[model samples]
Target chain A: MPNADGYVRTGRGSPPVRTPTPRSRRRGVASAAALLVTAGTLAACGSDDGGASSLTWYTNPDAGGQAEIASRCTEEAGGAYTISTSVLPRESSQQREQLVRRLAAEDSSIDIISLDPPYIPEFAEAGFLAPVPDDVAERVTQDVVQSAIDGSTWNDQLVAVPFWANTQLLWYKKSVAEAAGLDMEEPVTWEQLVQAAEDQDTQIAAQGIRAEALTVWVNALIESAGGHIIEETADDPADIKLGLESDAASAAAEVMKSVSSVGGPAFTTAGEDANVTDFEEGDASFMVNWPFVWGRALGAVEAGTLDASVPDDYGWAQYPRVLEDEESRPPYGGINLVVGAYSENVEAAYAAAECIASPENQAYYFISNGNPASNSTVYDDPEVIDVFPQAPVILESLENAAPRPLTVYYSEVSGALQRIYHPATAVDPETGPRASELISSVLAGEQLL
Target chain B: MSTTTLPPTKKTEPVSAPRGGLSDRSKAERRLGWRLAGPAFVVMLAVTAYPILQAVYESLFSYRLTDPDNRSFTGLSNYWVILTDSLWWESIAVTVFITVVTVSVELVLGFGLAMVMAKALKSIRPVVRAAILIPYAVITVVSAFAWQFAFDINTGFVNSWFAWLPGVSADTDWFGDKWLSLLVICLAEIWKTTPFISLLLLAGLAQVPDVLQEAAQVDGATWWQRLWRVTIPNMKAAIMVALLFRSLDAFRVFDSIFIMTGGANGTESVSFLAYRQTIARLEIGLGSAVSVLLFIAVVLIAVGFIKGFKVDLSQARGE
Candidate 1:
């Protein structure tokens, strides 16, 4: 017999080969064609750089605020260079990952970046940021927020230019404060605030979720109590110091436990959004959050979702103190402008960064994006004061704000801290010591997570 | 059907003879086979095999993306650290638990669903099938968001609707506790994937031969007895195939956990742990190590199922 239809071979010492059916053979050809098309498209993906040199500035997701700034900077450039904005992932860690990957490969297309403050040290240590020019540094640093300057520096060198500075404020309702017979103008300790919430039969909203926000809260509480997470023994991981088990850390944990325990059912999982939502709807009377809440409240009122008088009823003060006598240190958060080390247009990038973070632009960003300006002059501007009635308190809070631990291993430290201190009520004196040890072990490569 | 056209093996050759008598036509046919398979094979190798090999190569180094200059060869230290770490073990345990619970639950529920679709009237079969497939068609991230919102205390009605129960409070947070959070994650996974399993099983059910079932019924066998002895035994291949696929998918649960809890409340799966290291921390070396371990674990799981079930995988895999 002869083989027929070319679909099978069954003879002599060979294993059987079942050939493809006509339909399957057609599918094979189709799929192969598709693969070629895909490969061709991938190969064709190269930059179409026309005559003009374009700078790509990577920014955190900011609802087109950064895009507006990019366009403004480009127009101001007067044909020297064009600026384009590429939105980074919304999460700070994700943004860091993308930037780090590109910088490690020395991708020169990355001209500038909007950086989270805590990751500045890591980027600077890795030499991913260009050194700030002396003239530009002097121009940007005048009347800047101290914490913003502190956050953008690594090894005493200003590696990035400060753009905006954010610090949490103790926001409360006037009715809740009066009901509890508490003064809103003077400083109030966390203990006093918790008691007042109990007295008024209301809740305090804070970020308790296991995220960078939780780490920010923990660091603030510890810093306010005169404790530091890392002592900066050296840039080396083995020499890093942790003050997690100190008396100040214990005090911070005490406040964390109390606030989280009494916060409510979802306290363990509440984040910035949850707390803000609850506060807007009157579920909570007190919240410690970034200045963005003020703009959110006003917007809600304008949108008719909130009562007209709610903005008037809102009151603000400096972040609550961890102890009665100690001055409270608000948590600092903001975006910094950093020039990419591998950028072909280093001079142009620095010029654009300086222009974008100028006092006038900082004030504009404050009003538009709700991000507090790092330049103190921006706060003193009449328009900023008119828009933010609590501008003075914000300036004061930014002064005393405690930046999160500046470490080259911030991602590792933050992850370990969030893990050990999660469900904030679980944080006790022991959590600090445990977290410190874990951080040390993780950094030293003895532990992996 | 075409077997009669094949050349007789006895006349063709002895067992040890070389296949040297092939005509030019046969040689051209062999070349055509390779030519047709070439592009897809190359693409598959580039996309899949290259990354896997690269991951294995990177796992041997001490590489952090940020600290690019500091990378040095570390031999097996990365793997050693992961093996010794309790967090890795915890993630693996969580992954296995999720895989077992979700796959088992999905298997039972999917079978029930497939049965309904299979047994329904011809007129309604299309509608029932479409409805069953709706969850599967929804994007994984979107379905996860829907479940996350539905279970949220402030934004959801689940708590208020179930508040009358003794232990269920009106202010309950579904993601607060470890067990409950895992339960909710499993619920989301099952809801999304049970339809897929049902679709596969439906095909197998079609091949189960209703005449055998009717004969069993005529012989005085109860419905349950017929199901256990006749129906299940006949659909063993389908059941095994579904288990193999669903279990592998469930074992790598990431998106739901990442969105709902961000791996908090002790809910991080192995894939999530790998993600945190590789993407969040930029620790490429350690992340690759974790990925390799996860890959090994998946292979072991597949082997276990294949060995225990004695499954003839060629049936499901096809020619």
Candidate 2:
């Protein structure tokens, strides 16, 4: 059993004891020293040149809009700084992971970060973000949507600058709405949409895939029912109080259960993109998605991939309500700008972030990239209205939307919720309690998810 | 003749150290051997042992990467939390299920493929082997995406192509149900890795002597009898090696599940759970605990294969 002996020896033997002759040992030590030197050099290579006037903005994947804005902000800086854009991964979670790892190492190359709203609290809590100067905070928050402002703030301080705000709208086909006799002019409830879908023999597409998108859907449902996912967040993880056991949670669960039946056959796996595809080519007549769906549909029509009649029949309204009498709070999403605390050029980065988020640049971003602007003033831009006909509804949704729970342990809470409330058809009255227990245990370090 | 054989057998006898220690020449040879292997040993320690030891150390603390201020020495509580959690056990069960099913299926399929490749015409052997190895050549992530798209209801033709079969329709969602999702994930794993198993088995098949089959046939044995009693017994080492490698590989299944379902509908593997904890949740302590446990499980599996199955790897290597 020499092979077994080899395995055991390798597993247990200390490497330092293996040196034999003095001459060879000396050579080995020298080589090891050389290797250490090389590793040190490699580690040192990760830092940038620390150019006094250069700032790097880590932006989420988009259609060159962030890069364009970087160039614009650089030009506007009047030689104060030159901003360069580096794209993060497409998925928000990947973006968070990359940024978190680099920030944990105190990497100074990241001067600016286009952060997702849900992760802003985590980054801010970690001290990975530079403090927002009082003047910068005031200017950035001015005229910004309330949800965006709320999303950008942590611990009662503006931790990040609100860049663009996104909210879902109830998109419906006019023909289907008329056929189901459902009025599209007013806000509708989830029950009404399900009923209409059932009556019309069509689908209501919502994000049910097990991802952050699902968390957004779950958060919106709970918020619309007037419940916060975390009733009280504490400095200690164990002290966090979850609102999942509340009546509002049950109501949200009930709505999810009801809606799942009309959410198409592949409802459990339908993400935003799948829902869009279903809406255009399949039986999905109603969907709750970001305003990008409009651009996608029009783009498809222009490319001759879709019939022009689809966009012609499109109608948008406020997000669906969980309860008939209460107003719906849509899910708030988008990018916010955070300057790295380790950045040598923090001031320049802040200035560039402000320029990138200006109403004029925001309007340009909205019109060009199909991302909504956080500044409410951008909605009134005539060119914006020309590009996105549902600009008013989007602005209203953004104003009324509720951002996901703000907490340092957001990923754990969201992961737990996504695990328990998934495959929406399985959600029942008891689902909320189960999810609450899981989240509580996870937060307390008593459970794994 | 007896004296000549005695001298040769004495010459073959294992060398024993002199009264107390190795002779000077033997010591010098040993030193030379160590010096030759020194660099590789150091490289392995730096790359493998250091990180694993770091994980073991980190597993003793309650640390979240995002909250450096609150890190505390929790001792074995992280291990306790994971050991008592249902999600951990459920993921273990899922991982074991995938490993068992995929490895067993791939073994039988790979054996069949090996037989085909081994018995194919000499002129066309390369073509057959190349065709069979194509899936193995494709990257795992790319293959996972291809399989995911194939099973996706919106973008896939699988539902439409199989609509004629009972219970499968254009509306069939492969990733919607736990069992169905696991089935798809296992299918992807088996498809991408069976070629590797087959290639290994093909080497094993080539090592089996043709004379034994002919001799068995000459002795009035049936084809099945020859295969069972002669071919299989002679290739037992090969089979064991193939099973051991494939089982270990299958146990760490992550890429397909990550790409296809994102571990939805209870398809989470232990590796996926570790990733979710460490990368997604940023709980370094908890994730390291998961990793240490996974490492232990892998070692246990390897040990089991070696001890319980008496898999003599030396023999497999033709020593």
Candidate 3:
């Protein structure tokens, strides 16, 4: 290249040299790198702004749902917030795991958590959730049934808002009882109930039907029997007494095994369906179920689609009295709604929770969802009375319902019981030694406790 | 490509060449390698690295799912609690048991099927292969449910068939019973995962030389003898790859147990228990500890594969 104007063609000397100095060039590179880094950092921090700050509602999506209750609520409160509703899997195990991972991850994205009451203590204790507002707690403490509150409170603090009640109830077929030649006037003692089912077993079996009843419904029977699942011992804070191997437990277990004969030619009378479906078919003479069965089973019964497998003369029992001790009463517990401590908008979340737990919503839960109301105040009210003709019974069931031991090892305990229940592990029916041994192994609590 | 090269360039360049010693590459070329890998690297770091770091940090605390005042940094206590606990060991035992049973079964069946398919009539191969895939094609949950229903009393087809039994004709609650549940899960897993294994082995089978088998036969070796000597020796690399793949998958089992028994009835694997603690109990610290332990187990198992099976993971695996 040559210089301009009067310059002749030549090398560097003829060229106008304007390359940046090494120092200037280094500065330019450093400044550009700094700009990029700053921009990146800003981008990273700004991620919380868009499509976030909007509150998320994790719940099951209803088929007929407005489908955007969260968004609607947030909108009604003005543009200050946007609420996003995420439909999470409703399976019990799945729900529990997702909640744990989110909180463990320190996920600030989720501000509201709908907790099942049995799980409330764990979340609250782990500091994943904030305390309920004092006013809300005080009011809920009064309005909510004590049984529901018992499960939701951890360390004497209100950790969740009671969504609705789930009190166990006796569900028997009114019509099937008639066919089985039974009177449905009053609840039968465990023995009498078995006898009555035995009376009609032949006929039921001949028709290819089987009678069924709950084996785990001992809590109610415990209260009625004067036994308890766990008794708080005044003797020691470190001690919780379980009557699992006690006479009460044996009595309950005997009752469960005895009841399996109801519609059976044999063990075929018992299956996983003993929990729910056994009573769905019109042939079973009796069943014990919670309120959810009302919508799923009774609705079919009322609609005439199901033959109302429960006896024509239905029987209701809170739980059959197991040990008959005055102090041993069955406990009631279910799920509850909680606000996450990591949630940014605590007040908004609180308000949302309050709305969800309102008496009207409680009624809706009873009528539509087949869940009993957590609020005791709504029980005798004319509205709930219509929704659940058995509402009075459920209310009574709440006063002295049993709650599972809220220990960290509760799952392990339940799992142990389930394992022992498996026939292979269960001792020979002729002798329960093996089953007893397994239960003892479970009770030994080496790993989980 | 350059078999005959020029004579070696005798010390043309000094040993300590300037910083720019090699090729005169452009800045873009220098950066292209990193840029090409940048997205995947960033993604890998975000997905795998951050969670692991966070889990390791959380493993020091003793947090309870049902209690709040209980959440505190216990400084390695959570790990101690898990490691020292008998529950952890039992779960690990169960996990190993399930993994070994299922993976070993799958390997044998898969290899057998692969061998058969490799030598079967060409016209029937496609049909047989498709039939094998039908099981793997079925969703895990669906397969579990099907097994649950078939073996179930009250409604299962198994019970109806059992009615014809000499004495135990009643509905026995097939999977609800211990040992039985494990057996059912093992069967389902074998059925579902065997095809994937077989397909891999089939690829390996493609590489085995027909001439090698003929040479073995020329020595008057029977089918079993020839298979054990010639075929298996040749397929060692593929078998190793398949074993490693299936065993790792089986170790982290969750779906079948979750659906069939919810970790009840002695079917709980380490992952299922971890899930229960993390989700059901809402104990973040404990759950994270469990997770860290799981990752360690996986690492150990991976090393075992390398050492035990003589796997060269640096090369392609489970191809």
- Candidates 1 onward: DockQ, in order: 0.38, 0.36, 0.17
Give candidate 3's error at residue A26 in angstroms. Answer: 35
Please rank every candidate by lDDT, starting with the best: 2, 1, 3
Q: Which stretches of candidate 2 lie over 4 Å from their true place?
A: A1-52, B1-11, B14-29
Worst 10-residue lDDT window for candidate 1 chain A reads A1-10
- Candidate 3 chain B worst ten-residue window by lDDT: B1-10
For the second chain of model 2, what is the TM-score against the true structure's chain B? 0.91
Per-prediction TM-score: 0.90, 0.91, 0.71
Mind giving the per-residue lDDT tens digits that candidate 2 earns over A222-321? 9999999999999888889999999999999998898898887899998888888888885899999988888888888988999999899999999999
Candidate number with greatest DockQ: 1
Per residue, candidate 1 scores C-alpha lDDT tens digits across B1-319 of 0101112135454454447766676678889999999999999999989999999999999888877788999999999999988889899899999999999999999999999999999999989988888888777777787888888887777888888887778787889889889988999999999999999888878867777777777888877887788877777878999999998899889989988889989999999989988988788999999999999888988998899897767655331
TM-score, B chain alone, candidates in order: 0.89, 0.91, 0.83
Error of 1 at A303 (Å): 1.1
DockQ of 2: 0.36
**Per-residue accuracy of model 1 over A94-135 as CA lDDT, tens digit each:** 788888888988999899999999999888888889899999
In candidate 3 the C-alpha lDDT for residue A142 amounts to 70
